[model samples]
Target: MSKIQKIKGFSDLFSPESTVHTLMENLARQVFGTYGCQEVRVPILEKTELFARSIGEETDVVQKEMYTFADRKGRSLTMRPEATAGVLRAFIESGQCGAEGTTKLFACGPMFRYERPQKGRLRQFHQLDVEVLGTDAPQADAEVVLMLWTFLTKLGLKNLGLELNSLGCPECRPVFHQRLRDFLATIDHTQLCEDCKRRAQTNPLRVLDCKVPACKSLVENAPSIAESLCPGCDEHFAQVRDILDSAKLPYRLNDRLVRGLDYYQRTTFEVVSGEIGAQTAVAGGGRYDGLIKQLGGPDLPGIGFACGMERLALLYGQAQIPAPDFYLAVLDSRALNTALLLAQRMRERGFSGEVSFEARSIKAQMRQANKLGVKTCLILGQDEMEKGQIVVKDMATGVQKNIGQDDLEQALGFRKP
Candidate 1:
């Protein structure tokens, strides 16, 4: 038989690692809810054109990274390579933007991209996405940045730095793009990749995102859009920084940090961690004032950000590791029915418990309890059933108490624990 293996650049998220996923997502939901942001769930598959238009057709995500395929009906579709485009599409298609006048939305789900996997970068990843629509003020920009930092700090992420920049609005970007194109023209075309070479002619701003050593060298000296920001753009950037400062959040200016997508505009920033690996930017986002209009909706200004749930999970402390409160041990075949009844009753009483159907010995069941790291075990066997009593053992203290059926739930601390 041939060997079985996962697809290249993909991984299995199982067992304890899966617990981390739940923990991070729960914490993010709690934090998001506190800030008046409601949760949203979007589909994983979308029409290919949604991305082709929302994310730039010339960008890497559209040109190379997308997992696109034609369905049996001959309609082209793609898995969501990123969350922002799909979120925006949902906003326009649902008419939520029009009815609500503003939508403060948060979403957490898997995102797919066909790229080489590395330490923190994966072919399939999970992200916590936050988006706000119908707000153009600099206050909206700072609010999202401040909320992200607050959430990270609350999670005990230390020394997380904020890197900020503004790619300027539509009216002023063309002039700067011309200057950027002019600067790239002088560089040796032979040294750059075909994609970067093509980007030079089609969308020159994206060249800065290239990691190639020679290209990075050429682009390092290139003029930043920040320097050429029109008066309005400059004021807006300054105001955003001032708002962040007023909130007592520390940040550093990064002139060349334009996002990979074309929809992003003024006020881009990332919450970075040195501990997490090179793709350590746990969260990043920016304003997209024209995206709503571009997607065939009314002119609406929006800003948002997304954080990698997998990376955040890796950083959670020991306190976040959850343990089942109770383990229901069915000693042998005779006690199986009793164990099941007790476990179900415990659930109804708002307590958590797990039962094993393996028909293991008392010693083996106790070992499983210890391995699961739970404190209390409700041990049911023929002897205890014959006496109409159940033995509750404290795994940590090795203490045992025999309680009758009438007081079983109360004695086990089902309602309290």
Candidate 2:
């Protein structure tokens, strides 16, 4: 016999976990909608080139974390390791940018990233992503960050820290990069990781993101690139700061806070919490002003952020999602048909309920309902069925009452009893 087990880095979501996901999705959607962001669902898979071009090819996500494979026709494909690239691909592919004014879209979906699984990190996790396209104003950057901060605050995640930085537009970034490299030269290379050593020669900016204790200590006093921003980038960063002040959201400026993507330009920020270990970036995003044009779309600037739902859920405490309020259990063969019809009607009328499909005895059915945490159980037995009525039993109070079929909704407190 073979051992049955879930694959490493993956686990199942059953019952309350599934309920929690639904509630989170709905809550995020509601919040995004309130801010005039419409929901969009993108495919879970995309051409491998999409990410390679959008997220830097040198980044760990594309080089180490992406789940890529070849399909029957020998075309290389990959599950979307993140949502922003896929969202950008959709905007271009669907000609959404050409539609009209700005495009404000939100997406909630499963994102794939291969990494060592931990408490809040999973191989198959979810992200709530928000993107605004067709603007390059610093105000747009501020609004998006402000919106995210407000949203997270509303979710009761009060302990998060906002780290902000500006990567500067292409023309000014090279100057900062040279200065950064010069400063890094003073540090010993022996203390850095092999990857950081290699990155130093290639993508030197990423060397600052090193997590090793020795490397962290070495780079602690490194010069801030945000302080070196040229006139244009300087004004942009200032305006973003002004907006944050206006919104009364406190933030720490970190010059080394560059996003691990080449396409990202100008403003970049991350919302992190120390509650989780090293990968504490609960949400991160920034302005990718050149990304739209780079991806074969119109010359529109875009800004957005992606929040890891797993991390947020963990930090906020995973209160069990509520179960259905009522479970309608029918007894006797004659009542089964009516129970099925009633179950459908109850749901259609905005009631969370279920009816037994099997011919279980009344006691067994009631037991199942109690196990489900149902507060109210609808009983359909021989006497009630013959009298064209049902019994509404309050499981909590152990009170029962006979009500006609038409009064069922009213009995459940849909209206005055």
Candidate 3:
């Protein structure tokens, strides 16, 4: 039989690729923690209705991209394409998503989407998600956006820009939809892509988000949502902008920044980078005020965003892992037990390195140290053990010194005994 290969769109991440992903996750914890955001983990699969109701049924994500299947009992389940829906579903089920106190939570995990894999996008992808629940205050929107900005800035990524927009709430959005629909009537249907044609009939606002050149050109002079914001929405959006300005955070107000998700309302934003090729969006999210109640939870509001880990890895450049401080070489079978003890002692005191598991010749052991790029080597031989000492060699200069076993810590310069 032939050897088995990994799935087409799935990847086996190792070393530096997995390294950067870990660093990004840790930084998210550090930065989000500073802002009072706690971590939460939710299942990757859920009832299909969870997405259909949360993300609009007409949206492409629910209509085309979800990895949905049936269980033995015939109940439909879907691999999550995004994180916010599952995050909220957990809080709702646990009774924490309510009008009590503001809950700032973050989670990072794999998200599955059945779309064609692109440069930084995959059929199976991972996302670092952050969400703020239980408050509809405009300040919540600014806070979450600012928090996301802080996390990305900490990543040392360059050439990144934030795009901001306000998708008017239920109050004034209906009017804009009607205006957009009328504009579509004047254009020839053949000019729009099949997806946009369906979007125009089902969810007119999505037509504005179509990336097709033809559809984009047609919507160029179409109605702008800014022109239809109700007084409440306009003021809410203005407050969000003013707060971002006060924080000295620079952003561009892209009239077309409506995110792909349907739950977004009032404030929508995306962080794009020129470093990542065609798929430039490194992260994007917006406020979803009605999603909680709409999804059978308390009538709470939420704002959140997800940083695409794959795209972020592309932006983070290469990940570097520093070599160990030293290596322990056991040259004689009689010294094996002693070498293990020395290795354990050094590690307990915060020193790190590799130790030979079995007795090996000096030539072979030193070669292992050289391959690891370690600067110092500690040799434990039968003679050295009998003398109650460990030989330390400087790999670079080929200089050697003998130190008392008790003096190993001082020899390594870790700290005082």
**Superposing all C-alpha atoms, what RMSD in Å does each candidate have to the true structure?**
2.0, 2.4, 1.6
Across 226-248, the per-residue lDDT of candidate 3 in tens digits comes to 99999999999999999999999
| lDDT of candidates 1 onward, in order | 0.85, 0.86, 0.91
How should the candidates be ordered by lDDT, best one leading? 3, 2, 1
Q: After superposition, how far is residue 195 of candidate 1 from its true place, in Å?
A: 2.6
C-alpha TM-scores of all predictions: 0.94, 0.92, 0.96
Better of 1 and 3 by lDDT: 3
lDDT (Cα, tens digit) per residue for candidate 1, span 1-417: 999999887888875678777766788889888877888889999999989999989989999999999999999999998898888888888878777556789998989999888877788999999998898888888899988987888777786788999999888899889999999989998999888899999999989888787888878899988878889989998999999888888888888788889999888998878887777688899999989888888889999999987777666634445677789887768878887887888777777768877567888889889888888888887888889888889888999998986686677654653
Error of 3 at 414 (Å): 2.3
- Among residues 3 or more apart in sequence or in different chains, the pairs in candidate 3 whose N, CA or C atoms overlap within 3 Å are none
- Segments in model 2 whose C-alpha atoms lie over 4 Å from true places: 1-4, 358-363, 403-406
Best by lDDT: 3
Worst 10 residues of 3 by lDDT: 408-417
lDDT (Cα, tens digit) per residue for candidate 2, span 349-369: 778878887667878988998
What's the true lDDT of residue 22 in model 1? Answer: 74
